[model samples]
Structure formats: C-alpha cells, structure tokens
Target: MEEGKEDLETLGEQLYNRIYPSHKEIAGKLTGMLLELPGSVLIQMLQDESVLTGALEKALKALQLEQEPRLTNKNEDEVSVSSDSVGEQLFDLVDVYNTGYSQKITGMLLEQHKDAVLHLLSDPKLLEEQVNLALKTLKEQSVEETDVSDSSDTDDTERLGERLFSLVEQLDVLHANDITGMLLEMDPADLQQMLGDGAMLEAAVRKAQAALKTWN
Candidate 1:
C-alpha cells in the first residue's frame, strides 16, 4: 500500500511538472485537482499512514513558496520597465477599455483626465494610430525615466498601466465594432490618465487610424 501511494504521488508530481512548465505558482491548482480524485481511493491510500501523502503536501507547499517570489518579481519588474513610451501607454489605455477591467481603472482615470478620454474614445481607429506614434517617440528618446520618489505612487502607476495594457490586448482579440462600443462608453478622465501626457494621447489616436487602415 505504501509503495502504491508513492507511485501515485510520483505520478502527480510528473503531471504537475508537465502542465506548469517553468511556472511553479500553479501547484496549488494541481493539488486542488488531486484532492478532488475519488475519496475512496484517497482514503484507502491513507489508511496506512502514507509517507507519500506527507511528501506530496510538502512538495505543494514548496511550490507555493517558489511561486510567491516569481509573482512578486513580475510585479516589481513592471514598475521600472516599459516596452514603449507615453504613446504606447495611450494605446494601452484604450486596450484596457476593451477589456472588462477597464471600467474600474478607467473610472479612476476619468476622475483625473476626463477631456482626454473623451477625445480618444471619439474615434477608436485614430486613437490607435496616435498611440503608435507616441510609442515611436518614446523609443526614439535616449534617456528612459525610471526614478520615482514615492513607492506607492510608483505602484499605482504600474497597476494603472498593467490594467490598461491588459485591456488593449483583450480588445485586439474582439470584433472591431464591439471594441468601438466599449471605448465609447469609457470615462474620458480615465482615458487621459492612462495616456500619461497630451502628446501620447495624440499619438495614440494617429496610430489607431493607421492600424485601422492597414486592417481594412
């Protein structure tokens, strides 16, 4: 029975490694699935005080701990790192609006920069084009500004950017008309804050237009 239990645990570990690959954070999910297996089988295995069960629990805990650092590292990396410039950020904001999370972040942005948001939403294609231009400017700039005095402020900005970018990527996955409807309904202030600056706002609109032309 003990040997059989060991075999089961070994199989579970193998399955976990195959599914998660480099991501250890999914260990808890895998464990949850394992626990859902037939109760009778589990009980029968455990009747003899199996060491394999103990090992499995420990392995799951280890995976959780390993995953914690990776998650934290990912969040930290985003704070000081940006793929493009203020222009990219603008397109990213629109991108977020296309996603479900946009409402929350967009509401916050609208509370700060209502006019900009309205301008961007007025024409989705144009906004995307402008964003691409803004991104080009950011890329052209030699010096990257990464220093921030306030940690909280940095975190807030990072969160806003992430939410915005995630939305944009989601929009790219949707139908064009549905994407347009989502943008029209978003708050203007929110759009402005996500754009970060006036230049980015203009660039994003231009980029959107260019992209739309190519798509058509």
Candidate 2:
C-alpha cells in the first residue's frame, strides 16, 4: 500500500508539473484583463459582485470548459479505474463550474494573496499530454472509449480568450500566485490606474463588454 501510494504521488507530481506551467502562464492573462480597472473603479465595480462573477464565468466559458467528467471508483464489468486521472480529480476542490463558488474561492484566494483580490483582475498550456492522460482515466473507468476531441490546439492559448480561459480553469490557487509573479511583466499599478481613471475605466469596460458579445 505504501508503495502504491508513493507511485500515485509520483504520478500526480509529474502530471501537475507538466500542466501547471501552462495553467499558470495562461491564467495571468485572463485574470489581468478582468482586474484591469482603477482601484477606485475596482472599488466601484466591486460593488456588483455578479458582474465580477459573470466576467469570470464568461472567461471560463470562452475557454470551452466542458463539465468535468464524473469519476467512477469501482470497476464496471470489465472496466477498471486508472490512477492517471488523479491529476484532474485533485482539482475537484476548485469547482469553477459553480459561478458563485468560483467567485467565492477566487475571493478567498485573493484576500490571502491581496495581490489577487485587490489588483489582479486584468489578467489574463497542454496541456495536451496531461489532458489526454486525464481523459484516459475516464475511458478506463468505463468500458466505452471516451469521445474527447484529440486536438491539443483546441485550447492551446492562441485562440479566442475562451480558449485560454478553458486552460486557466484547470489551475488551483497556488498556480494562480505563480502566474501572477510572471505577470509582473505588466504593471498592475499602471493597469489599475488606467481603469480607475473615470474615462479609462469606462472605455475599457465598454470594450470588454463588447467583446463578450462575440463570446457566443
């Protein structure tokens, strides 16, 4: 049992390292865009939590996030569960599909890392092997072959904002912090001031809302 546990942890670490990099890099871009308002404007926008939540929901949906496949613990007939999917299952704690829950957890993460709760919105991977491994777990748990899209390009960070959003959704909070560190490339203060200024904030928000129209 101890050896089996070690193997699971080892596999989990390998998969986490592979996907976490892509997850963090992309998460910065999507989160940065949303939090792009001025502190004052953010103070104002913060008044409407639904808008914030909706923005988050919008970003994830754009990423083409599908419902996470349900996991089965026991074998069904000839089917057997695989240990590989432990990676995807590990993130079950972060239920981004639940808009309210996503918002709440994000808020909690941001507060602990005020950098996120206060200034990190404007923000802003393979992703392939890991995703395939995750899908493989589902296929193993059931007898039927899982019909997942085999295209890694489908969510490879170059497409629509949604494509990136889908990738970011896979991240847990620790990865969020790591991504923010890299995003220091862009000045949060500058972005914040740009949004806080009445005119700039208004303009950016308008542009963002307009972009959402094409999200469908």
Candidate 3:
C-alpha cells in the first residue's frame, strides 16, 4: 500500500511537470487560466483551496524573480544587467493571444488553452493592424481557392469584396469594445447584406451580447 501511494505521488508530479515546465511556470499559467476560464470551471478547479493557493504562491515568487535585477558579463572588464527566461517567453505568447487581435495561432491556442482564453474577447489593445493583416491573409487564401470571369462575375467579385471589407470592419469595431454601439447603429438591411444569412447574423449578435455581458 505504501509503495502504491508513492507511485501515485510520483505519477502526479510527472503529470504536473508535463503540464507545467516548472512550479513557477505552472503558477503563471494557472493564474492566467483562472482569470480567463468560465466561473464554474474555475470554481471546480479550485475546490481544493490548497491547489489554488500553492499555484498563486509559486506564481508570485516567479514574478518577484522576474523583477529582480541580474548582472551580465559584457566583457572581461565590463558587466551589464539582463532579464530573460523561458517563463517570460511563455507569458508573452499568452499575452499576445489573449489581447483580442486575431492570429493564425489564436485557434490553436484556444483549443489547447481554452481556460486561458476567456477574456480575450474583451481586450481593447488589439489594434486594427493585426485584424487587417489576418483578414488580408484570409482573403488571399480564399481568392486563391476560387476563380472569377467577366462582367457578371466581376460584379459578383465586387460584392464579395465589399462583404469581406464589412466583415473586417465589424471585427475591428468589435475588438475595440464597441460591439453594442455598432450593433445598435447598424441598419438592419446593411447588417443582413453584410452578414448574408439571417441565422448567422443572429448567432453573431448573440455571441457579441454574451461577450458584452461578460465584460460588464
């Protein structure tokens, strides 16, 4: 029985290490996840208060280490201060994805780290540049997959282009924390024309509404 218990403990430690590279790394990841995941999941994960407390404590310690000054040897006679770590890199990646602007990595991160992605929809720092780049990439890929001909086809192409433009505009406005105002200001005909399907439009509106409620 004692041996079995020891084996279980070892397995747990191994699992923790795989999920988190280090105790400090785990702390930051858990803190970020807790801040982002739904309330119910967060509560369930924290049911054992010690688990939550320990992660927080480790994360705080890691933050302190990150803030502390470090000396670097620039040459035989000179020294400089430098700050760098794997934890910092991981945190930076998380920050980029969680800041609301879309990237190709966003979907991958969302799937792999759903708990750490909850509040992304609310970040206003995500600028139009990122959105434009992502939209441009999508448009280029879409165009490559389809071909257009003359006159009537050209008109259809123009209409499709307009719809793409509208989609990007809507995404930018939504990321800028103006979803409700945008929705209210949008003419029903324009919204329908931009979105093209009533069901999809309604679904998008509901998602925006939910995001707003979460923000509030």
Q: Note the Cα lDDT for every prediction shown.
A: 0.41, 0.34, 0.40
TM-scores for candidates 1 onward, in order: 0.21, 0.22, 0.22
Worst 10 residues of 2 by lDDT: 117-126
RMSD of 1: 19.5
Using lDDT as the measure, the top candidate is 1
Over the stretch 1-216, how does candidate 2's per-residue lDDT look in tens digits?
698557444544443343345467555544543343223433333456565455555545534333333324565433422211221222222332222222223322322232222122221221223323434443353232123434442232123223223333344232332222222222334444543365653454344334323321
Tell me the alpha-carbon RMSD of every candidate.
Answer: 19.5, 22.5, 18.1
Candidate 3 stretches with Cα past 4 Å from truth are 1-132, 148-200
Model 3: lDDT equals 0.40
The order by descending lDDT is 1, 3, 2
Off by over 4 Å in 1: 1-13, 16-148, 152-154, 162-203
- Model 1 accuracy (lDDT, Cα): 0.41
Per-residue lDDT of candidate 3, residues 26-77 (tens digit): 5445455334323443344446556455445544454454455443345623
